[model samples]
Target chain A: MSHADPVLEIRNVAKQYGQITALTGVNIQMFAGEIVALLGDNGAGKSTLMNIMCGALPPSSGEVLVRGEPITSLHHAQEMGIGMVYQDLALAHHLTVAENMFLGRELRSSGLAGTLGWLDSARMDRKATEEIAHLGISTLRDVRMPVRLLSGGQRQVAAIARALMWSKAALLLDEPTAALGPKQVALVLETIKTIAAKGMAVCLIAHDIPSVLAIADRLIILRRGRIVRTLPAAGQTVTSVVSMMVGENDDAAAA
Target chain B: MDRFRHPLLGGNTLWVLGLDVLLVIIFQLASANGAFLNPINVQAILTTYSQVMMLVIAQTMLLGAAQIDLSQGATAVLASVVAGTVLVSMSAGGDPGPHITLPVLFLVTIVVGLLAGVINGVLVGWLRINSLVATLGTLGIYLGTAQVITNGENLYGVPLSIQSAFGSVYLWRVPLSTLLAAVVVAVVWIQFRRGSFGTHTIAIGSSEKAAIRNGIDTRWHMVKLYSVAGALCGIAGAFDLARFTTTDIGGHGNDALAAISGAVIGGTSLFGGKVYFFGALLGALLALILQSGLVILRFPPFYQVIAIGFILILAVAIDSFRNRNEMR
Candidate 1:
C-alpha cells in the first residue's frame, strides 16, 4: 500500500449534549483513493462523529481540516469539495431526478435571457443523463421521473450521484446500504468501488461486516465514543472483527 | 404522460376553470335578455374584481410557500389611507382637492405597503413566529392605524384626473387596471414556474429541514416572499383608490376573505409547495360571477355570502382529499 497524504483529518473532536457526552477525543484520517468503513454498535457515537465531520453539528472541541486547512460550517465544507449524503436521502419528491440533481444550483440561459431568469432545463437534463450514464446507474431510466416514484435503491443511487457531482475531495455516506435489499446493496457496493477508483476519498458508515471486509481498505471500529481498534481488511474475517467490536476474544473463550 | 399531468388541465386549475364556465352559463341562462352576457356587464364584472384578483395572486404566493397572510387587505387599505391622507392634506388649501400626481401617490402607497409587509415578514420569518398568528396580529395593527388616521370615517377628495387615468383608461376594450393586473399575474406566474426563487420556495415548503441541509436560506427566502406579497397589495391599494376615489375602511371588510377563498378555490393549497396562478385568477372570477348572478336572480345579498362560504368549504375539502391521494 502506498502511503499518501490524508485528504481529510478530524483532530480530537469532542461533542457534549448538556449532561451527556455523545463523543470525546475522536480522531480519524481519510486518504484519497481508499474506502474507510466506520463500524460501531448502537450508541457508540458513530452518528455524532459523522455529523461533526459533515459540519451538520458543531464539535464542542477540536477542528476538522480539509486538505490540511481548517473549515467551518457545512457551506464551507462544500466549498472545499466535501459532500455528505445523510441516511434519509434528502431528495425532493415533487421534483424530477434532473431537478433534484440540480437543486439550489440551476443553470440559466445566456445573456439577456439569463438575466430574465429563464432556466436552461434542456442543458440540465442532458448533463444529468450524461452523468448518470457515466456513473453506471441503470435503474434510473428516465431522468424526468419524479423522485417519489423511484425505488429505494434508485433513490439512494441518485443521492450518491448528487453528492459525487459536487464533492471532489471526499464523500461521506451515512449507511448507504442500510435500507437496501441484497441486490441493491451489491449495486451500491460496486458504485462505491467506482468512486474510490476515481481517486476520491470515501468514508462509509455501515454495520454489515462481510460487505465492509469485501470492500474497505481499512476498518476502524468504535466502542463507546472511541476508536477501539483499527484493522487492515485484507486478511480479517467476520469472526475476528466481531470479537474486536465486542471487545472480547470469543474464539479464545471457546477454546 | 407529462402532458397528461400538465398543470393547466389535470391540476387545480381545471376545477377553477370548470367553476368559472359553469357560473357564466348559469348567469347567462338566468339573465333577462341575456343581460349577464352583455359586454357592458362583463366589463363591469371584470373591472370590479380586478383589484381583488391582484390580492389573490399575492395570497397564492404566501400559501404556496406554506405561509398565510391575513393582513394583506388591511395593509392595502393602510397604504391607500397613507396616499389619501397625503392627497387630502394637499387639497385642503384648494376647492378641487389635491393636484398631487398619480405617480407620486402610487409611490407613497407602495412604500407604505412594503413597510407593512416587511414588518410581518420580520415577525414570521426572522423571529420564527407562526405566520397565521403573526399576520393576524398585524392585521389588527394595520386596520387600527388606518382607523386612527381616518377617525373611522371615509377619506374622499382624490383628484378626478388621477382616477380617470388609472380607472378608465382602456386598451382594446379592457380596463387598464385589469390589464395591469394581468401583467402582474403573468410576471408572478413566470417567477413561480421558472425562477430559482420559486424553486427554493417550493423546496422549503416541501421539507424545510431538507432545504436547510441543502444550504438554502429558508428564513431569508420567507422574508422576501412576504415582502413581495406586501408590495403586490400596495399596488392593489393604488388601484383601489383609483376605482373608488375614496379610502373606505368599511368597504374592505370582505377583501381578505375573498382573496383567501379565491386562492383556495383556484387550487392553491393551505399546505404550501404547490401554486396555480391561473387557477387563482379563475377562482376570483368565479366568486365575483356568483355574487353578480345572485344579485341578478333577485336573491338577497346575504345569500351571496352563504354561497361564497359554501364554495370555500367545498374547495378546501376537495383539495385535502386530492392531497391525501397524492401523498399516498
Candidate 2:
C-alpha cells in the first residue's frame, strides 16, 4: 500500500446468475506492486470476483473502482488497465507466438491501415522476441511457431508476456499454474513475483494452498460467496488457512 | 512417434497438397490426353478458379471461425436476380431500365448483402442459434424469396453494357474474376496472416470464453465475419450473373458446399481457430480443376460430387483427429 492509491477497489460487490449466487457483498482492495492470492473452494466465488473485476461479468450490486474512479463502462475497464489471463490462456493455437502476442492490438505500418496494407512484421517480431526474453522465457525457440506447438509452460509464458506487453495498470491471472507440471508451476510463480516486482499490481486466483502461499504477499479467502478472512502471508500455515477457510473456531481448533 | 504426434504439421499439409496436385494431374491426363498443361488450357483453368476463389476466401474466413452460411449461394442468386429484375422491369421491352444501372445494382448488392448478413448475425450471434441450423433455415427462406421474386422464370435480358463491365472485362489476358480473386486472396492473406481481425477471429474461435475474458468483443467480430462473408457472396453472385447470364436455382447449392469443401481442404480447420487463404486458393483450384477435367474426360458428371464428398469426409476426419490429439 502506497500514497499512489489502490489499483483496484471492489466495494460491496455481489453477482448472481439466475438462482445461483456466484458472489455476495465482496469488498477488497488491491494495491500496486503486490501479489494478492484469492483462494476458495470450487463454489466460493473466486472466479466470479475475478470476472467482475476484469469486466467479464457485471456485479449484481456494488461497484468497482480503479484509481479512485468507479468503473462504469467496459471501455473504461480496459482503458483503466485491468487485464485478465484465464486458465485456458485464451490463446489462438493456430497462430504464431508473435501473432498471438498482439491478438487484439497489432502493430502495423502507417500506410497499412489504408489501401496498401502492410504489417510491420519485423518490428512486432523483434519486440515480441525481446519481451519474451526479458520475461526469462528465452529457452523457447521460434517466435513464428504456432502456440499449439508450445509446451504448457511456454504457452503460459507467452500469455503472460502478452498481458505484460499490453497491460500497464493491473494484471489478473486465474489459476495460472493449475494444470502445469511442477517445474512449469515454479516458473509461473517466479513470473508472478517478477510481475509484482515490476510495480504492477497482480491478482492470482489459486486452488493449491502451498503454491499460493509461496508467492502471495496477501491472501483473500472466500467461502460461500463471502470473504471469510483476509490476511498477510508472513508466517501462515496451510492447515491454519484451511481451518479458517472451512470456518473452524480458533479456540475449538486449538483444543 | 512423439515427434509425429506433436501439434505441428507432421506431413499433413504436404499430404493434402500432394493429393490435390495428384488429382489435378490425373484429371488433366484423363482429359485432353494431359494436354491441359498447355498455356491456353492453363488459362482456362485459372479463369474458372478466379471467380469462386474470392467466395472461397470469404467463406474460409467464416468457416475458420466455425460458422457456415447456407444462404451464401442464395444471396448470390438473389443479387443477380435483383439486378436482372430491376434492369428488365424498368425497360420498355428493349432499352435497359435506368432503375438498374450498374452502380445502383452494385450498391443494391452491397446493401442487400449487409442486410441479409445482419439477419444471420442477429440469429447466430445475438439470438444464440446454432450457425448451421440458422443459416440453413435462412438459406431456404432466401431461396424461396428468390423464386417468388422471379416466379421460377430466369431473368435473361441484362444489357450488354451492364454485363460487359463485369463479364467481358479483362485485365490483359486474365479475366477480371481471376484478377479480383488474386487481389482478394492476397489482401486477405496479408490481413489475416498478420493483421488484427485475423488474430481476433482466431482467438474467438480458439476459445470464446478466453476471448471474452480478454475484453475482445467476440460477438461483434462474429457478426462482422458473417457480414463480410455475405458481402463477398453478393459480389460473387453479381459476377456469376454476369458470367452465366441467368440465375438458375438447381446448381448453386453445390457452390456453397464446394466452398466448404474447398475451405476445409485448404487447411482451414472446421473445428475453428485456423485459416490458410493460400491453402484455400489451392483447394479451390484443385476441386475446380478436377471437375473441369471430369467433364472433358466424359466421366459421369456425378463423379465430381463423389470426389467432393470424399474430400469433405477426409477433411472432417483429419480435423477431429487433430482436435483429439491437441486435447491430449
Candidate 3:
C-alpha cells in the first residue's frame, strides 16, 4: 500500500466560519481496495470533512489530492475519478433506473443523428445492467423500471452503483446506512465491501457504528473538528469506538 | 412507475380522448344539419384549434422543466403584431412573392417570440425569481408592449397571398394549416420521446438539485427551454397572421390559461417532471370540441366557457383521486 500513491489524500486542511473554527490541521490518506469508516459524534466535523473532500466546500488552508493531482471543483473531482453519493442519494425518481444512471452523459448515436441529440437507449440500458451486475447487486432486475418503483435498499444500491461506475478511484458516501433497516444496512455494507474488494477506495461517514464496523477495514474517528484516532476496525467494540469518538480516549491519553 | 409511466396512458388522457370522441359523435348526431361534422365547419375547428395546440405544446414543454410561461399568448400576440407591422411596411408598393415575404414574416415573428422567452428565462433561471411571479410579470409586459405597438388597434394590410398559400389552402380536403401544425407537433413529440433534451428537462423538473449534482447546467437548460417554447409560440403567431392576414391583439386574452389548462387537464402535472404532449392535445381538444359542438347544437356561445370550467374541475378531481390511489 505504501509503494503506490493514495487514491485520495487530505493534507493540513482547515476550514473556518468567520470566527469559528470548524476543522483544522486535518490529514487523511485513503488507498485503493480499502473501506474506511468515518466515525464521529454530532458536531464532530465529519460533514465538514466530507464536504471538503468531495469539493463541495473548500478548506481554508491545505491541499487535497486525487491520484497525485489536485482537484479544482466538484465536477473536476468527478472528472479525476472521485465520486460522492450524498445522504439523500439524489436519484430522480421520475426517470427509469438506466435513464437516471446515464442522466448527464447519455450515449448518443453516431454522426449527424448524434449531433442532433438522438439517444442510444439500448446501449445505455445494457450498460446499466452490466454495471449493476458487475457489482454483484442482485435485486435490480429491470433497467427500464422507473426508480420510484424501487424499494429503499434497491434505490440505495442503484445510487451507489452510479457513483462507483462513474468514479474510478475513490467513493465518498455521506451516511450510506443512515436511513435503512437492519437488512438494508447489511445489504449496503456488503455492497461497500464488494466495491472495496474490486480495487476502489470507499470512505463513508457512518452514524450506525456496528454496520460500519462490520465492513470497514479501518476506522477514522473525528471529534470536535479533528481526527483523534485512526485504528484498525478488527475487534473494536462499538462502546470503544463511541468512547474514542466522544474524546474519552483523548482524555485518557492526556491523563 | 407513476412519474415516467407512459404519458399517453397515464392519468386522465384516455378518458379525455374518450370524452372528445363521444362529444364529436353527439355533436354530429345533434346538429340540425350535420353542421358539426360539415367539412367546412370541421376545417374551421381544425385550423383554429391547431393554432391553440401550438401554445399547448409550448406550455407543456415549459411545464416539463417545472417552469411556466404566462406570456406565451402575449408573446404570440406581440409576435404577430410586430411581424405584421414589418410586413405592411415592406409590402407597401407591390407584394413581394409569397416565397420571399412569408419566410421573412415567420422569421421576424419567431425571433421576437424567442426574445420574449429569453427575458423570461433570464428572470426565472438566472435571476432566480419564482417562475410563477416572473412569467406573470412578463405576461403583462409583453402584452402591454403589443398593446402599445398597435395602440389598442389590430394591425392590418398584410400580404393577401400569404394567407392564400398557407391559410386557406387545403390538400386532400384537410386544412393545410392543421397539417403544418401536425408536422411540427409530431417532430416535437418524437424529440421529447427519444432525445436527451427531453430527459434532461424531466430530470431538472424531478429534482433540480439532483440534476445539478449530476452535472446538468440547469440554469442554461431553463433558458433553452423557455426559448424553444417561445419559438413555438412565435410559429403559432406566424400561422395566425398567415390565416387572418392581420393581428388580433384583443383576441387572445384566454390563450395562456387555455394552454396551461390544456396541459394540466391533459396529463402533464402542474408540479412538473412529466411531458405528456399528446395528453395536452386531448386536453386542449376537450375545450374546442365542446365549444364547436355547443355551437352546432345551437347552445349559447358563452355556455362553452361555463362547460369548460366544469370539465377542468372534473379533470383535476379525477387526477387527484387517481394519484392518491396510485400512492396507496
Clashes of each: 0, 0, 0
After superposition, candidate 2 runs with Cα above 4 Å error: A1-7, A10-29, A55-67, A112-119, A139-142, A250-255, B1-21, B31-48, B90-110, B162-176, B318-328
Interface RMSD, all candidates in order, equals 2.7, 5.5, 2.7
Best by lDDT: 3
- lDDT over C-alpha atoms for residue A146 of model 1: 71
- CAPRI tier of model 1: acceptable
Residue lDDT tens for model 3, A63-139: 79998888888888888999899998889877898998998998997888778779888889999999999999888
Interface RMSD for model 1 amounts to: 2.7
Q: What local distance difference test score does each model get? A: 0.82, 0.76, 0.87
Kindly list the per-residue Cα lDDT of model 1 for residues B167-201, writing each as its tens digit: 77778888888888888888887877667777777
Docking class of 2: acceptable
DockQ values, each candidate: 0.43, 0.37, 0.55
Best by TM-score: 3
For candidate 1 chain A, the 10 contiguous residues with the lowest summed lDDT are A246-255
